[model samples]
Target chain A: MQTLDQERTSAPPKQIEDLSLLGEVSHRTAGVSRLEMCIQCGCCGGSCPSEADMDHTPRMLFAMLRAGMRHAALMSNTPWICVSCYHCVVRCPQNVHIADVMYTLKSMAIEAKLYQDSTAPDFSQTFVDMVEEFGRSFELGLATRHYLKHFPLRLPNMAPMGIGMLSKQRMNITPTRIKGIAQLKAVLKRAKEVEAAS
Target chain B: MNKYILYPGCSMESSARAYYDSLKAITDIIGLNLQEIEDWNCCGATEYLGIKLTPAYALISRNLALAAQQADGTRTVVAPCSACYLNLAKADYYMQEQPVLGQHVNEALAAGGLSYKPGSLDIRHLLDVLVYDVGLDTIKSKVVRPLTGLRVAPYLGCMVPRPDYEHRWSDYEYPVELDRLLNALGADVIEFPLKTECCGGHMTQISPDTAFELIRRLVSAADEHQADLMATLCPMCQMNLDAYQSETNKFFHTSYRMPVIFFTQLMGLAFGLEAKDLGFGLELVSARNALAKIGIEHPAEIPTGTARPKKDGSLPMPAPLPRRNMHTEKGKVVK
Candidate 1:
């Protein structure tokens, strides 16, 4: 039933256009990510606890990367859905650094402005803003501001828990700035400059 | 006594104050001498790393640099929080693995008048220090009150074990370090396959549905095992399971009350320390009922040859897997 004629008539594989995508991700990942060693194994997808929430499995995302589907890959919710549990990283037969690569994809998505939803990115940005400002995370402020911007209706529901945590002295109402705030800011400022230059 | 520099992460001062309090209550008994790293900032906790590379590493490296400078007689830096432990260890490992990263991070640190040479300090989790350094035999000897009937499910969460760059954990997927430690405290540690599962991390804020589902699974698993309570080492895991249990139940339309608490609190209980001093009532989900299961007197021993025969056609339950000894000296430091 299988004939050489059918094989000859079949279309050729799509040419990989965005070859820099893999290089960029691997380079951005810390240490040797081993992204190039991926063998299309579905271990990363299978091991992911949050795979149900992802629009594309890591394996599928890798395929898309190979096919040079930059827009589709960047817009996919796969990277954002990652919990960074490292389950896939350990389970990957090829030893691919799946979780770290997800981090890279997230930063790249933010850079290209190709993310489908603003919730995760906004949370990360807000968290970063708090860290940059006070050198510590103010959970109450983070929750209040994030909920006000995204889910105002849920604020009323969250009040009881907030009151409980506050009354229990579990969370501080105000942020605590570290003593070396000025020093940390200088280090971070220099880090940003170096990152931008590289 | 073994000495180590303590890096009590941001959560210790905030959402996980109970962990800090209970840890302090038991340290003297276990002989863990902790000198807190002064003016230590947050490790950027799983967020800043994704936003920027060099700055995030620099932020974590600052602590390492501080620890290195502050290391008097001890070169071991112990972090109680799982996220803090992983971040510190990862920064150290990566900086050593890739010299270019070390150069960039050091360049940034130079701006702060600080520089860290990779592999200078031993970055370890508090749990690791307790099991490996303090030894379970010593912990058992200090137990004046045994948690005999209270069944506990040990939850380590993510971050702590996986991506073990230094090869510290016995098995990345199913490490038994926490389980063995809890067993030493006289609690009936259950067979919890979801021990190392993710607690949805920050998804509790970004996507409530995702976090709820994951939390529901963990709670449901413990309930299925007939666990009286769940014990966790990570504050994030405890917060997600305890603070969000009601939300998870509501989302699933199920009425299940599962109490989640830190391992240190249980350790304090076993050491005969008062519950109030260990920060018992701070958990959103009340751990009172679970704590009540600890009887004032030990139960009388059952006579031998009183075993009931299995019913016809009833399948035999599989035996529990043996816990591996992860105390090997290998992989203590990566060269």
Candidate 2:
């Protein structure tokens, strides 16, 4: 796996047409119109709780889009810290739909295989594994697997927390899969079709 | 009479059974028909969409499509689980927001011989329906056993209110619909600051300490408010607060036995429904003791002290506003 640093240095500037991935999905989704409504106001940036942590604020991102600086927008850590709080959309004076735009941007980045993060993919994978196996998110299993996947050496560290949760009967160690896994698989298939068509 | 397609999710059948039972009982009493979507799948909850966006959303959207197909006329889809509600709403919102994602997901759906028309259904959290459709007046009327003496801290969690696509909730940071519902039930609702705080969701599994710390803040705040119990609409919040209270205490080396019950369960009790029938006893942190404090021995009997206003009509009303001087120093008359 190439580090984000390596990808940053080696990757060429992403062209605006590369954003077509977003257009494909955003077309059928209200997210596109929401993105179009962005007036480059700083409400989304100003309202973000974790704005300090982001390399580009939501406003700057829109500004980048308007300026056609696709590569800079795609490579920033702004999308990762969004927290998906629709506060930006709620607070925007011009009704700029910030959250959907952020999601589209994130999707575009992921599809381009740029701006790789160590934790997000593992977190996403853990979620899929749980659903595929049990037709739902097994909290304990997901937590344990996520920690194990991300921090292999921290296996023993989870004991204190695990025991703490276990004693309270919060951590159900026994895996409980839904009755029919085929139904979940079918759902996955259907969603993929939606992803493709849009 | 509002009819909706119900997506009970997995927790409603297992961990949060009381939510399902009480919602059913109350909706029935209110004359609302909740038709369950046939062959509904898991919502991917808090974790799946994070792992693989396409499949995670697909998994959730598949259920929405099924609910929409199953909808006779009503376009609203109601989910009791906060994670389920958020996932369903998020998928629907995103599919419309990102056409490429919509295309990809639709293509995936086509493979399964199922396609979803975006925006076909309005996804609503259970609390939204209770507050909006079944107004407080109607809820107030059904109070056979008022929770007058009981004090409850309403917990909304992070998912339900935020990113509220349908505008179902109040301010994301401090929603009061649950508190309003409880107050209408005659319970002393506490003003909790961490009402919309994260219950660590699935973070408890990935980072126990982080989850514990978050849970501790919520539980501790409720305890500080002298709340008799914590009322929640989200199963994940209920699970973390109820099932993990003892563990959180152990981690912090403190003791807390606060019972976490579904808001619907408390409503069921207030509605004079059977306590056992509402699955009150099924909770890991039993609410039986709390129920006893309100003079509710069993669900059948109307608890004492829950009577309506006396014939004399002498009930506490809001204090009348103090008379204001008509003229100001500048000789401007206040309207």
B1-335: candidate 2 lDDT, tens digit per residue = 77888899877765676778778777877667888988777786654543346776677777877787778988999888887888788778767876666777776666556789888889998889888998899999989989988989989877788778767777877888998999999998998887877676655554455567668888888889988899999888887787667677866778988888889888888888878777665566567677788887633322222235577768777976764332353365532
- Share of native interface contacts recovered by each model: 0.72, 0.39
Q: What is the per-residue lDDT of model 1 for residues A1-198, given as tens digits with 9 covering 90 to 100?
A: 223244346553355547667777889988788888889979888988887767779998887676556777788889999998999988899988888788888888898998878988999999999988998888988888898988888777666667778877878999999999999999999999999999
lDDT string for model 2 (A79-149, tens) is 66666556676678877656656656666666666674646545756666776777765657766777777
- The residue ranges of model 2 lying beyond 4 angstroms of the native Cα positions read A1-30, A33-85, A92-120, A147-198, B25-27, B51-54, B93-104, B170-173, B207-213, B246-257, B281-289, B297-335
TM-score of chain B of each: 0.87, 0.87
lDDT against true structure, model 2: 0.71
Worst 10 residues of 1 chain B by lDDT: B298-307
Cα deviation of B66 in candidate 2 (Å)?
A: 1.4
